[model samples]
Target: MSITSAINLFRQLTVDESQVAHQGQPHVVNETCLDLLLIEMVQVLRTSVAETSFAVPHGGLPPSDSLELPQSSESTTARSNEEQERATELLYYKVERVGFRIGQRLAERYAKDRPRFTDTLDIVKFICKDIWIKLFHKQVDNLKTNHRGVYILQDNKFRWLLRMSGSEGVAHATQQAAPYLWFPCGVIRGILANLGVDSTVSVKETNLPQCAFQIKINRAV
Candidate 1:
């Protein structure tokens, strides 16, 4: 659903402010708090992954083969490459899991008063409008679906990336920024899962601050 439409719908569904206030004042926090937390989270996860990746097993004893001879340069490089790839994967997993739990909790809170969603499209629209606005302070810029089971959500100015930049070229900047999206991808999946949808969410960034999230519903058991 477009933001405008969503706003109208929200107005119709919303309760009076005075009534809501009687419950409690809405919680508010500095937006930068989340941004800073995310930055620290990624760094901490990366460090943990690196340490785990290189930690020695068997009480820190060197392998018997390592005592015999140094590995060839090619073999050593290959091993390093493998370790780096594994570390990256592990980092993504950790960050995404955090996001998944977050999304689940947020869904529980936000979906409390709403009527049960009618279908998959209804759920997706809720994410595009209410969820995005709640998290990012804006609705998704564009939402596209294949009328099958695939939906693409594009944000021209993703709040998380608005202030982020890289000294290197665009490609390097993109690579650096890629990990940040893993958490949100997990969040989307978590939200859907909580809403009774099974799906896989992935992201792509060709330009800074402009990214697309593709959510593919998993129909197979």
Candidate 2:
């Protein structure tokens, strides 16, 4: 289902603010969070279908002598690793772009009621507490900074990953979780960019139901 449709369904199920929130419970979807979820879901569906359609047919392997070599095993491994990293980074950028747009729109509306920030840290704090509470129904579990423009935001019970099962092993689980993570990573990047901070966002799944997002500021020279 599209995120907008899902959000409408959610709204239809709830009667009022009381239903949306209780004494101390997180909401299933907030304005931006549901939007991000929808974006991620669409991408996941697209990737799955595309991959299925493009599967390589079973065939004989290429002749060893015909294939080019990287000179040594270590060099081949390094080259392979570089390619993998490049692919990973490209994926993050795609996800981050979606989020950045969402953040831009959100920030315009958000600014209507908020005061100006004195520094970049203030904006990060807003994301950690206020913005996060709106999206997740609770503040981030922890926010740490290196005092050198890098920040780590940890969420112990990340809402989207809560229902994910780890029975399939970490690789499979991460595959399942990546789409959901991507949009949020984008959202954070977008928010920062909107706030005039150039930054990169990445996710690390330390364990099931536990995730950390690293936000690194990229200052202009």
User: Which candidate's lDDT is highest?
Assistant: 1
TM-score of 2: 0.65
Q: Per-residue lDDT of 130-171 in model 2, one digit per residue for the tens?
A: 667766779999999998999999999887677776687977
Show where candidate 1 strays beyond 4 Å. 1-20, 23-25, 56-68
Candidate number achieving the greatest TM-score relative to the actual structure: 1
lDDT of each: 0.78, 0.68
Candidate 2 positional error at 214, Å: 0.7
Encode model 1's per-residue lDDT on 152-214: one tens digit a residue: 999999988887888988788888988889988988898899999999999954478899999
Per-candidate TM-scores read 0.85, 0.65
Off by over 4 Å in 2: 1-45, 48-91
